[model samples]
Target: MEFSWLETRWARPFYLAFVFCLALGLLQTIKLYLRRQRLLRDLRAFPTPPTHWFLGHQKFIQDDNMEKLEEIIEKYPRAFPFWIGPFQAFFYIYDPDYAKTFLSRTDPKSQYLQKFLPPLIGKGLLALDGPKWFQHRCLLTPGFHFNILKAYIEVMAHSVKTMLDKWEKICSTQDTSLEVYEHINLMSLDIIMKCAFSKETNCQTNSTHDPYVKAIFELSKIIFHRLYSFLYHSDIIFKLSPQGYRFQKLSRVLNQYTDAIIQERKKSLQAGVKQNNTQKRKYQDFLDIVLSAKDENGSSFSDTDVHSEVSMFLLGGHDSLAASISWILYCLALNPEHQERCREEVRGILGDGCSITWDQLDEMSYTTMCIKETCRLIPAVPSIFRDLSKPLTFPDGCTLPAGITVVLSIWGLHHNPAVWKNPKVFDPLRFSQENSDQRHPYAYLPFSAGSRNCIGQQFAMVQLKVTIALILLHFRVTPDPTRPPTFSSHFILKPKNGMYLQLKKLSEC
Candidate 1:
């Protein structure tokens, strides 16, 4: 009876299909094993921490543990192989010389970022490479010119003042410490909306339930989760997962919001609203610049292109700035002397005026030093990644082949004792012109270095100076001991819990 069942035509086809599937699986396994072996052979020169055979180094290195990272950095010296799984690893570069060598190359960004971020940011400057990147960069460069940035100072000041007013109310009404990250995040969003979208949004004063704001936060969490969870790395698997579905829904929300704004701007432009050259130069925002921009071929950015850049700016502009400004405040709170010194410098520059000017921004030398030191200690974007496009040799004669992934640990570089004495100390003087000149140029990379550096760094600096100076002028910030901040390194380095601080209203302002 069994022999007769096996002889059936349908049974023969089913058996063949099963055998084929088995063969395919075996082939994939063999291929992966060979690739892993090749990678191990290539990376044999670099030191690496002990890794599990199956789990790799995921157990040893975690996002929360800075001490363990420091130990690894010390043991590995210049660079090390950080294995994510049996078949995946990155050549982690922390040495200034290694960073300088790799960053100067025309290497593309990591393949993982290219795979993951395009779904959200849609091949914006942060995601694009080579010719397309060059074209978009040229077109958008004028949007951040000094003249354009100068016009944004007033808008930034107004946003900061609104935040201060809220802080004043809270300090007067209650005796409790305030979690400042949320407030600063909202304020930064408010500034980005006015300056980038040319729209005024009372994000700081309003509730945080707005769809755009909520979507950004949730989507970031999902993307960061996907990056670390190896199984979710596959588009097919991720799309079928619950988080993936949520990502699609939230992405639509963000796109719809931006598309609406772009359409409104287009309608206004079509209606022939005109401005004189001087007026346009003084008042044009990022939206205006990109909308009217034309390339060498007299081509304007497609709606998709504009949408991508806007989404990139909206997320990059506000979230990172909020982290930076909040951390700067936290550092200053911990070191009262530095805080007082920065406060006095701002006072000297502004006198009784609360409004900051473009010229006065330069005069806050001490404050700038504090800001730099804060960024060095707690960089907003802690790690930068690149995929080598060609074989590269480092200063120490170490070599990595093309197609290898390299991670530049800005946190490790900043904390490396070889680069800075007493790396953990909050010393603003470390950034003084004399001391800064003595250090390696790539040793401190808050906005990264090279052509792929943060495009909005100048704009971020202006906002930082304006917000910090104004806040210092009005309120004296003190750390809350009961709620000391814990560090979390997700997409951005931020307080794990929240940045809680006591704000005492100052009579000076």
Candidate 2:
């Protein structure tokens, strides 16, 4: 009788605990079901492609599905519902009027991005929202002022020349076509190191062995892969995975590098080193500006804030710009006539001088048009994402609730048949002054649009013009007929098979 009573007491508690857990789980499942149903009802107004009950539209949205996406765009016109999973769906927008209306709003960035980016970049200006974002934006504005950007032109030209010299040596020795993306990536990294941190890394030459460069590249791949893999979204599951382990290791290397620079700069500032060496320096780099900036109330960024901003700028400044320059060269190779015109225009302004000036950048109008057109067809950054903070009503009278996630498809908008008269054609004349004036203001958002546009746009433009002009001055680029590129879009738009072109050295005038 005593043993029976003891067993009953223990078994009763166990049974109750099991019952409680089962009830809780049942309630949560029902809650999710209701939420999904509500989302479907709200989004019923927009046309969507067929979706799996479990997979949603995941199969059709891979990086290589551009043709499928284009077909859907043609069938659906302006906007459509994109379901990522059984419960989560976002509106994919492509029309210019719809894009303008959506981008002009003050909605915060998508919560989806917030979950993934913080592990890599921390909560910098790219990820921040509300009053905090505004504060950081104001503090960092002076770093990109015209005077500062003008000074960076010299740094940019030096980096470009370094890459060109290496290419000249390679081309002289062999007749093989060159894969230019990796080379351009290193050059872009070198420019950012010199222009932003005032450090000359020589990464363009030693990229194979550079720890910081390797870490940045690996970490970018891991983050992009994690974003697409739904199973890796959970913190507990990701923490135990192979990618998560690699991410942690690479992040330590990157953080250590950034921290060392911050500490060195801090020590220099304390000793009055930078302030005392005014004659040696023509202008301040991004590090000096951010370290010294103060808000209206004399507030400055914390050490954590400084690290986040530095890392964000370091990553953002290089990758997209590299993609832009590579695609521009590829497009020029495909159209030799356009290439010759751009080369002529560049030579006319530069006139045997390798040194590019700020004024000369303005004179290469045809070259600038070519760059803009390339961006339209293959935008470096293809899409911008946002989450509505309040109900948004489109120009067509369609309304999205506050929590809806929206993707502004820059690629689709640029290719929209309604917006451009022959979207597929590589026509630089489409960007002429008269033609550009008649287009919608929201059209041609290679660097994005609105109040939250890219902070370093002027810096990027100067770098592109300087790099391309110097490259054209040195080599005559032609497409390799044996190897054509396949386009893919992850974090940035890139050629799947790598960008290869033949480089014939130009005879000196």
Residue pairs with backbone atoms closer than 3 Å in model 1 (clashes): none
lDDT of candidates 1 onward, in order: 0.86, 0.86
lDDT, candidate 1, 338-371, per-residue tens: 9999989988899875667999999999999999
Worst 10 residues of 1 by lDDT: 273-282
- Residue 435's lDDT within candidate 2 is 95
Candidate 2 vs. true structure, TM-score: 0.95
Model 2 spans with C-alpha error above 4 angstroms: 1-14, 276-278, 507-509
Colliding residue pairs in candidate 2: none
lDDT of 2: 0.86
lDDT of 1 at 491: 71
lDDT of 2 by residue, 1-509 (tens): 99999999999989999999999999988997998999989898887988888767666656568778788888888989887778778789999889889988889998888887765678899998889999999999999998999999988988888888888888886665999888898899899988888887888886645787668667766776666666677788998998889888888898999899889888888898886653466778999989889998999999999999998888788878988999999999999999999999988899885578899999999999999999999998888889999999998899898999899999889888788888889999999999999999887898888889999888888889998998998899998889888876677777766799999988442
